[model samples]
Target: MLKIVKTEILKLKRYHILWAGIALMLLSVMLTLFTSMANDGSVWDFTYMIEQVIKNNMSTIFPMCITLITGYIITREQKDNTLKNILTIPISFKQLLVGKLLVCGILSLFLGMICTIFTIMGSFLAGFPGFSVGLALQAFIQITFVNLFLYIAVMPIVILTSRFSSGFLIGVIVAFVYGYCGMFAAGDMKLANLVSVKK
Candidate 1:
């Protein structure tokens, strides 16, 4: 199990997925900073600003990025035909799948923490009140837990897609479509409420 997990981590070392995750974190930070500045530090109450930022940005970005990474993690192995080799190495399929999930999930959580830290610092530097280290940690924990659950829920779908075709593109498309549908449905509901309000 340990060896399989380590191997999975090593495989991800040179992948563009890590860099993409970092870029997403940076982008989230920049957006949060801009919003804080624009609000003149008054939009969200200080105590809740960090929580709001985490809820808004991480909930959306983290899941999408993790789903992409998870797809690539499995699909890349299939692409190179290395999955068969790995499977022959005495590792159970469950171990291999769970190991990969752990490594990818941890990486995703690390990225989330980076974004959380940036938000906390940016909020403070912007002179937003109610910045608490404890609260920031709480928000981080909340977001990470939610992301972990989402990753688990989506893992089987990703694995199934990869097993079918060994096609990273297809896996990515499927994951994105799944996520997009959920988000779109939520947005449609919100819009319906607005339309009803104006009626």
Candidate 2:
């Protein structure tokens, strides 16, 4: 499994889809910055900025973004005609799938860090008040863990899509709707609890 994960990482070294994922991560921060321009007179600070970024992550960006990327990775074996070669090496597709899932968990953490960096940069650029080392550290930990949990939430979709060729495209659509629903759920405690367990 470790070897499979390492090989998957190596394959991703040149994978252009990663750039798309990074761009999506950047889009979350960009959206947060754009929201900061509102004249509603609400005070904006580092902590609030981090909160909004995490909100956007959960409500808009991370779930679908990670799902899309994970789906691509899972289906690539079929897309590139490499499954046969991979299977010939004495590994079952089930094992390969598990390895791919593990790789995605790790990838989610790395992307989380990237998102944190972008959030901090966005905060600085937007002139958010009350910046502090403690807040930054808190943001880092929160965003990174939130990403991992979000990835976990979307894992079933990735696994389902992996069973079909190019099914990840469908997973992307499902993930977007799935994530968007969270915004509505958060408004009601009952709905939020139901949705939390549903995921």
Candidate 3:
């Protein structure tokens, strides 16, 4: 299983999928930066900016981004017809899929960190005050852990969608809408807690 996971991670090397994830991760920061043009009368602080990044992530970008990347990586085996060779090594499709899922969990946290860095960049570039080491760590935890949990929420979609031929593109659309719905589920702490995987 460890070898399988390692192999799965190695396949991501030189792959453009992670590059896309990085760009998408930066996207939330860009969106928040754009919103600053409106002057909504809300003070922009480090925490506030990080909150915006998380809000945008839950609503628009991260879930779909991860899904698309995971989907592509999984589909590559089928598209390239490497399943037979993989099976020759006696690895079942279930084991392979599980390995990909684990790797994606790691990837989600990685993208979360990328998002946090850009959140700081967005805050400073926008001239938001109240930056501090503690705030940075909080933002990192909030964004990274939330993302990892959100990945759990979307994993079934990613897995199911990846199984079909050319379904990943479709998965992106579905995952986006699915993730966006989480915003609506934001009424109560108990309900919002459902949004967290730690529950």
Candidate 4:
């Protein structure tokens, strides 16, 4: 399983879809910056900017981005006609899927870190105040953990969709709408509390 996971990671080294995920992470931060330009009378600071970016990521970017990337990676073996070779190594399809899922969990954390970096860079570009080491640390933890958990939430979708040919693309669309629905969900106090930790 470890070897399989390692091989899966290696397969992503020169993958173009990986870059698209990174770009989407950056786009989340950029969207936050654009919102900062609005005269909504809300003061933007490093912490607030981070919150906004996190919101954007959860509702708009990370779900679809991670889904698209993970789906492609998982299905690529079959698409490239390499699944048979993998199966010849005494591994069942279920074991191969578990390995891929584990790798995607790691990928989620990696993309989270990438999003955090882009968040900080976006903060610098926007010149938001109240920056501190503590805030940066908090942002990193929040963003990374949120992304990992988010991936877990979307795992069933990936698993179900990967069974069909070109189903990941459908999964991508479903994930986008599924994620975007969170914004509406947050509007109701009961639903919001159910979905978020109460401070």
Candidate 5:
């Protein structure tokens, strides 16, 4: 299982999937920055900026990013013509799927860290009022974990998409809606924090 996971992670080293996540992170921060122009008199601080990045990640970016990345990795087994070779080694498709999913879970954390890095860069670049070393460190931890949970929340769609060759795009759509629905559930005490708490 660890070997399968290692293989899956190696595949990602050649794939540019992280670029998509980075792009989305930048866009999320930019969108938040654009909204800040409304000037409602809210103080912009490192923590506040982190919140905006988290909001965009939970509601817009992380879901589709992780799903699409996972789906592509899964499907590439067939596309790259390696599935047959892998099966000959006595590794079942089920095992392969599990390994790929596990790798994606790890990938989600890496992407979360990337998102946090980009958010901090965006904050400093835009020169939004408040920033302190302590605030930045706290925000990094908070935002990164939030994004990791956001990926976990969209796991079902990732699994669903992995079952088909042409499901990546569909998975992206489903993930977006699923992530967007987090907003509705977030207000309910029962469902709020469900993403972070559930598997």
Candidate 6:
């Protein structure tokens, strides 16, 4: 398992997927800081500010990052025509898929936790005036749980896409559309409302 994880990490070195998470974390922190500063220190209008921060960051960032990473993980081997070689190795298909999913899920969850921690720390540093360590920890736990659930929910789709998709681009498009678009379409009737409004 350690070897599999290490190999996966090495594979990520050539990809922008890992960096996307870091960039998003930095961007979220900057946004939070700017928002607080721009408000002239009067943005304390909620009891769960840290929780709000986590939600805002995750909702805005996680979908795209997770999709890109997961999509690439599913498609990279196909793009390089290495899946055949990988399959011939002494590993079960289930193990390969599960190992990849576990590694990617851990990476995503770790990034999410780091972002949440930074947000809370940034809030405190910006003198937001209501920084509770307990609240911050709670927010972290909640965001981590959400991240894990999202990862598990999407893992099967990724594996299925990998098994059947003919090309990298097709796989990526399918994964992104299904993972992100389907999510919005299922939850937000606003898209339908907007279409009807336009009509």
Ordered from best to worst lDDT, the candidate numbers read: 2, 4, 3, 5, 1, 6
- Write one digit per residue (lDDT tens) for candidate 4, span 1-199: 8998998889889678988988999899989999999998999999999899888989889889889988998899889899889899999999989998999899999999999999898898888999898999999999998999888877888999999769999999988887887787776887665444211
Best by lDDT: 2
Q: What tens digits encode model 5's per-residue C-alpha lDDT throughout 1-199?
A: 9998998888787888768867887788888888777879888877788888888778877788888888888898888887888899988899999998899888877877777788888888878878888888887788778777776677877887777888888999988877776777776766655543222
Model 6, 157-195: lDDT tens digits are 566666654543454454444443433553457753432
- Kindly indicate the candidate among 1 and 4 with the higher lDDT: 4
Model 3, runs deviating above 4 Å: 188-199
Candidate 3 per-residue C-alpha lDDT over 87-153 given as tens digits, one digit per residue, 9 for 90 to 100: 8887789999999999999999999999999999888887889999999999999999999988888
What shift in Å separates residue 109 of candidate 6 from its native position after superposition? 1.8
The lDDT per prediction is 0.65, 0.89, 0.86, 0.87, 0.80, 0.63
**RMSD after Cα superposition, model 3:** 2.3
Query: Which whole-number lDDT from 0 to 100 does residue 181 have in model 6?
Result: 49
Whole-model lDDT for model 5 versus the true structure? 0.80
Error of 4 at 191 (Å): 5.5
lDDT of 2: 0.89
The model with the greater TM-score, 4 or 5, is 4
- Reference-based lDDT, residue 194, model 6: 30
State the TM-score for model 2.
Answer: 0.96
Q: CA RMSD for every model?
A: 5.5, 1.6, 2.3, 2.2, 2.4, 5.9
Local error of candidate 2 at 181, Å?
0.2
Runs in model 4 deviating more than 4 A are: 189-199
Candidate 5, 98: how far from true, in Å? Answer: 1.4
Q: Of 3 and 5, which scores higher on lDDT? A: 3
TM-scores of all predicted structures: 0.73, 0.96, 0.92, 0.94, 0.90, 0.68
